[model samples]
Target: MPVVLLLDIDDVLVLPVGYKRGIPATLETFTRRLGWEIPLPTEADIEWFEAAGVTSEWDSTAICLAGLLLEAARLDERWIVPDFDEAMDRLAARALDGAQIRPDYVAWVKQAGEATRLGERPSQAALRLWQREVLPQLPRSEALAALLSALLATTHSLSCPTTAVFQTWMVGSRAYEEAYGRPAPVEVPQGLLEQDQPLLTRDGARALTAVWYEGRLAPAFYTSRPSRPPLKEPPPPLPVYSPEAELAARLVRLEDWPPVGLGRLFWLAEAVGLHENPTKPHLIHGMAAFAAAIASVDGIIEIQALQSAYETLQAGELKGPLAEWAEFPWHVVLVEDSVKGILGVFRTVRRLYELGMSVRLTVFGIAPHPGPKAEALEAYVDRLVPSVNDAIEEIVHLCREG
Candidate 1:
């Protein structure tokens, strides 16, 4: 068994007072972040902040990530205080935080209610319907909480070892909301609720998966969001399944993993080899095979391995024979919206290889030409060709420098 500390950054640990949508700190917020406010970025603020050179999320993520690691180590503050760089560089997921429910999942859930009154406006309709539709999806039934405990345990173990993910806010209630755009039907205890803790926050703290730090898995953190204002301003923390409650959830799903909307999964299957009628009864057969093929990447499951597994699934899902993976020079392809100008880069690729200077990544584009010239790859490089060739050379130069 393993325990993992999942930390979120938006409203749990830091936030800006009047941050505008799509804009980074207004110079004022920027200054305070370095000193006082831990600085939580709104969903839109990440990109805006990234470009403005706010400390890399990785850097800040490391410090917070170490908190749980410290508690787990039993060595406490001093041990974690020194390993900031390694933790920042290694402990955290690059972009694994926040939550947004898929719209389609809710649509399916709500369809069951005939003429159900949700609301008139789109926002209100969705919220009201989710209350009716999504609440039933996770009702506490026979052993539901217990099964959740095991899954949470497994997830905790996997989070650090296989693409370590400490979601700044991967709350169960959040997952409830992520799946249905609303909180879980469960209520917060009166004591926790009285302190002004959000039901989501109160619920998530309970949901953290527990782990034994006897070096069973690599050292990892397991804790809840500290309620202090500065440390608690980021996003809410993800919940863990208390061991008992978790086991209950597994039993709840025992009949099967409740079918997930697999449009993306379906699309991945088609691309990978999932067919309606296939020689194989199942597209995937094992967790390892499935994990090898599909993994949580950048906070989303990438089904590449699941598809790759299809090639091997015939006898058993083995990494397909090398011939299947062998990369050949791709055909000169002109895709939709393509102009004739792409050929210039193709020519440059051919030329560079001939010159014994093959590019690792080939690129070309039209430059802001002073004027036009003979349409040719050489003409572009020579600056004697039209905007197309000139663009190619400039593009090539930028690519090389980049």
Candidate 2:
């Protein structure tokens, strides 16, 4: 069987510098251009929002919009609830759950989510805001689109052999579909065309099918019961005067790293690789160094409170096409750019393996940031490479060896 190279979009096939730079401005533009009276988040707020996104329970853009709404309401007496802090907490909780926000904010949040999830063209609202508020200021969207197109073409050439048996499916995050654009016939290179046979031929390779995101088909195509795993018990509090606690304290004061919630810190400390402390693994050591660079101004108590709520959030389960894909006799490669992406891929691989599937899983950690608890992942995935091209080369070598 031909190897099925599952790709990731952001930071994997395409550098995410556009996303990293454009998103904040996108959020600000939404508020200003749409007349939503939402207050702009401070740098501290942005850090908190990004940290929350690591959980994957909430879409990062949605959380950004929710934070702005809550902050705006908190500052303006006219928009304030009786219990400002409590209301803000409730909003944060809802955002993490991926619940649609109030109508005024929902359109922008939905648009942003769609851009990331489906790779759909920017919504009118997003485009208008960008043109008016962001385009003149900064131009990253065009570059992002060009990079996405090139990635799609490259993936097609690598995975879809001109003559072969078995199908090639693109299994990835919502953003993975951005290259194909909602499924029209894609033009293959002239060289590939010469060797290509009918897609349905018994001995011919199947044309690439741009379907499945996060292991499920598009929402419109299929619906399944939401997988709600039981919540894990919260980690015990750090002991006062311990080295762990001291390190946690120091992490919160750093100016460069995103503001990790105290609960996340505790979780990180107990997490397999991070728990090793002084004699830490490279990935863990890298995380500690990162945390020191961008410590938050928020106090431990405040972060702990946010962490308490975050703990209650549930992550969606992988099902449908993704699960089915695991059963196929294909070499599966997962490419991701963040610690969260690596961790999620690891969990999926473990689950598939437990189900008695013989999966040859290789993970590519593309341009992953320094911080994040990803050390244990190296053990779960068969191989970890630095880039997509490296991953593709590894896949080719593995197939030849086989």
Candidate 3:
């Protein structure tokens, strides 16, 4: 089959370098629209925000916005008293007393701690106020839609079968449900490309494919509730590689890879190692292969569990059932930016190894000048390029080598 190219959206397709700048503008928009005067975040605040983003602590910008709103409300400390302090202190006491804390309570304490670390203390009252008054009043979904729309407006849009998979801790929160309508399920939009006009705007069409409230796919702290199901069986070992002729014949049968592209096609094809692609119809097929690969484990649908299976395969504890998923693509390409994305890519690489497939992994750093974390990914990925364009060039070079 044609190489399955997996791409990440955040920094890879859409550079979030403007996020720092967007925060102030977003805050201003919120203020003007809501008639609330929220102070703009300073440079130091932006720094902390970005740092927190790298650490995957929270939705830094969202939290920052919440903080600004809390400050704007200027609610009386009386509101902050019993509920905030009492609840927090109760949790603290429970921890000290060796009492098991409720998951919701633990989440609240973590948020409070993060707020404290960020030099903002959001009393439970402030949170309640925001949920009741501010969050609902704000155009949360519209703002997100606008942001994604703006990004797509600037980039080369995908014409092929494409899906957008979003993972946000906020989606699982009651606040999110209260703010937006119930989260959307996994589905493609009808009439997305109708009469040469997309029914929903490009972003809206993509949004239809979004799968949210599945926090098990993201970092642990992001979700308040555990979504992973228990594992049932051990995963099977990797399968032996298909013959070269068999692999080439499979690619010839795929209609998605056009003849023109195939004419210029190098021996290797690109495939993306994605964390989530709930909207992609082929996702079920891939997940089936993944499930077969890890038959012993339950919850293979969860990204975290899928990653653990990949690790087991890597350690040689698991063997290949390559014959089972012989149609799995080879010479794939994967691109990632976030910590979660990188981890997903790592697992994909191991999976490929188990299948006797080769991969060309590209780490498009968050910025032109990435930090140690991005650099550290070099140990795992096959290549580290500055941008997606560079990654394509690298793929071409690899093809020529073969």
Candidate 4:
């Protein structure tokens, strides 16, 4: 049986400097513009959020901003929370700004996220809960209601200012305009995207490459990074903004591997009304990546074919033409760093079994340090490796054993 490797990009194959720094930078920009002077989330704070399944930086930014607004609505007496548009207009015009928002808001957000179970959209769910449960108690105002609605719409809409500014920081101003068909809302000379560093060593990259070429393993990128639309036949010019996963793949010389990223999932939701986010911790993302990997092994690289495979599996239909290549006695391995991602693969394996598909899943979580992430990952992952290279070695050994 050919082993399928579902690879996570950030902190597994790469350090994700762009996303890590870009998140804080996005918060800084928002705070500076609003004169809120809110403190940036610490690395530990980010780790907690990730462990709690708030993996998307866009979501993280929204959480922080919404938290501040919630706290202000409860405590700040003088200032009234404006609707999303009025706030943005004032921010753009440099009219009036507010004072510092303390760290208590983040703590409250954490509590709320935990209570709500942080579903598919953690930020939106938490905020909506706050809006419904807590907002009603706060001297009811149209502005507060409108502000809450807009904040919830951040992940829901592509035209959101927060997402636009964050993407601009990650892809740089020029690339942002090229990709989004408009000038960046925020002025940035350079993008943080290029600052991302590869974690995979040359030898490790070579080993994976060698195994891939030998037909022993089929590897594909399974990440939450934004991607261009997955089209059967792309139009005249290929997109220049290369998906974030593509950028990470290039850093580790795995550019040719199939990628099942946020863009494809988003497109699928729009096309078939599947779901808005099937990203990690959600089994759909893993199932899609598994389909893409199976397609790749059969010399089928078009994303449309991959999508067909995914749709077949999603429907639990095993006797379809699209699923002909997928068969029994499959071995799957996931290399991930986030606890939520590992749990996602675990759920995906269970789901495969429920669908009567014979598949065995082994999860390798890369947690080098002793902390919350490592401790949490230990519960779900089969093996905890110090690095992806170590995980790769184990994978090769596992392949050889059979």
Candidate 5:
């Protein structure tokens, strides 16, 4: 059997400068709206959050904004400021170290339930902690509560203000309105999405393509980015602003491959009532990526049928082509820049092994620097490389030797 490769999008194949820059922009938009300016998070601060297992930029934006509100409330409770806005003003006045923000925010998250630690629905966990701890200490003020509510609100669509603002930063104002059916509060002619640069080198692309064509490697993508709904027919033209795996694939000339993204998960939620997080380090996402990769190899071109195959795998009935995958010895290489993706695939591979499937696992972490992300990756991944190019080059060489 060919080596099955599962790749992550952000900080893996692409630099994702868009998302990295958008985090602080999202924070600034929210804080300015609340009538005070505080120190925005730096890139290192963002890395700290990712290393701590809060991978989704949406959740990161929410947590940072919520922490700001929590700080304001904390100051008000201590009589340091007369009002929330004044408290924010006081905070803005101090040269607060951005590095301290992650620790304080993480402390609040640590107080939440067990799911809070491993990139599980952390925004929701932070909300519960706030309602239980901070909400009670302050005098009842509807406006303040409403601001916090907007910060923590969840929605299937882009109705949540924080999500809406982040989308605007990502896709621009015009495209944002078209996708979500509402005018963006912020207006920019061009989106940061266009600014994202591909990280894969030419040699890496050629090596990957050669192995893929030589029947030595099977590959697919798994990511949390919202995507177009899976359809039985060929996917439609890219929307004005869709940062889906399809977009990433196009950047690397691998658009023919399949990716199991959040859009597919949203469709599953509506069709089968599968309400699991459906993102790494969650098992459902790992299984879905596995199914989609196999489907690509089996010529299962219909998106709906690929989803059905995933359901069959979940049911543990390997009656059809899924059984064929189990019969062959397979090497599964999960390539990711974050620990969550590696862990998710590890869990999925273990589940497959329990079902008597013949599969071996290798986790490759794309960590270029000695930061918190690299440190976290140390715990989960088998090898740490600087980029996907380097990882793919090594994998290709291994296939040649074998």
Candidate 6:
């Protein structure tokens, strides 16, 4: 089985340890060290973690293979697959004890558990108990095991695999009461959810509270309070490429200039080619990046400069609301073959956006129809989506500047 590597706290490093201090006072320590908080596990769900050689210090769940990543040498954190009985040897393990739980999160789960019933409220008393009692007593190793076991029993998400974890709070008190009949289960500590509770997954689920824990934890507060103001004194721009990064600094010069022309265009395409091509199929997708890079290259004014500009465009900076457009209820993602013919998608997206139909496109590179008239987009998807003939031409048309 391909095991999933989801963590409880997305950020699993110690903030204080870096400054030669102990753990940081708040969740900042967790975020500073680990990047994001995965999900909290209950006492019963620990077996899964132990099976994977993960130990939870009061503040972190350490992984054996993370040492390599910490040392900047490797990223293979999985249980290695052995070849023909070569029993996979364990990689380096790290300590996960002697840390502290993020303070605020500890309180929230606890409140939810105690306010509700053991098995009566959303998360119940059991999970809270685990959070309050068992976690403190158990050594890092034991706490991790118990917590993983408790969490896995009711919270393991089969749908959101990979680093993605789906969790909820105060889900289905009556349902929980029916299933567990206790505020907290015996095996779980004080605040861990008891068995027989509704495990929240997607945001749409009624009984569950959906959460997205990617690198930054702020999505949890996306609709909440205003974010910290932009730094009054903006941080100075740092060089994007390191002196020893191996690539020529010329490649990193796109921050100020618009890349233009054939030579610059090819490099742009090549850069994207490097980013997308884990396999052969990506070479084609990379073309979009190539085209955009050409358009972005400095000192450009003609169609020819397109290739260079396409190569220079930074993707994330342009990728915002594009994802939102992708979620249009009526829109469906269909591959159009006719869109190809060397730079066709660029024009295609351009036309679609011109016509006012939001198109979620990612040919040669990802592009979206900025916004479109409803009828036109619906008609286009029906008539133009899913073609094998014009892949390049269509994508080139589809991805062009609006």
Please list the residue runs of candidate 5 whose C-alpha ends up more than 4 Å from where it truly belongs after superposition.
75-120, 141-149, 153-156, 232-243, 302-314, 317-320
Q: Which regions of candidate 6 are displaced past 4 Å?
A: 1-310, 315-402
Model 5's TM-score against the true structure: 0.85
Q: Please, what is the whole-model Cα lDDT of each candidate in the order they appear? A: 0.24, 0.31, 0.31, 0.71, 0.69, 0.24
Candidate 6's TM-score reads 0.16
**Model 2, span 74-115: residue lDDT tens:** 333232233423433443443332222232333343434333
Backbone atom clashes (below 3 Å) for every candidate: 56, 9, 24, 0, 0, 124
Models 1 onward score TM values of 0.20, 0.34, 0.36, 0.89, 0.85, 0.16
lDDT for each residue of candidate 1 in 1-402, tens digit (9 for 90 to 100): 111111111222122111122122221122232232233334333322222212122212222222223222232112222232343333232221212111121222123112223112122222344344432453331232222222222222223211022221222334434433344433212211111211122222222211111211111110111111111133232222212112212322211111111122233344555443110112232211222211321122334434444444344323432123223221111110011122322432343234333233222222222311112222322233222222323332332333
> Which regions of candidate 4 deviate over 4 angstroms?
75-82, 88-100, 105-109, 112-119, 232-242, 319-322
Tens digits of per-residue lDDT for model 4 on 1-402? 668899999889999888888778987887776666656887778777776667777777777776766665565433454657665554445433354446553465466446544235776676667767777778645677677656655553545556777888987888777766777788988989889898999999888888888878878888888765577544222221247887888899989887778766666666666644567766667777877777777766456555664676567765343456546567899998887777777877777677677788888888878887788789888899889988778788666564
Q: What value does the lDDT take at residue 307 in candidate 3?
A: 43
RMSD (CA, Å), candidate 1 to true, equals 25.3
For candidate 3, what is the lDDT? 0.31
Model 6 Cα displacement at 200 (Å)?
49
- Which candidate has the top score in lDDT? 4
Tens-digit lDDT track of model 5 for 249-312: 7787777777677766656655676655566777767877877777676676535445554566
Model 2 compared with the native: what TM-score?
Answer: 0.34
Better of 3 and 5 by TM-score: 5
Against the hidden true structure, what lDDT does model 1 obtain?
0.24
What ranking of all candidate models by TM-score puts the best one first? 4, 5, 3, 2, 1, 6
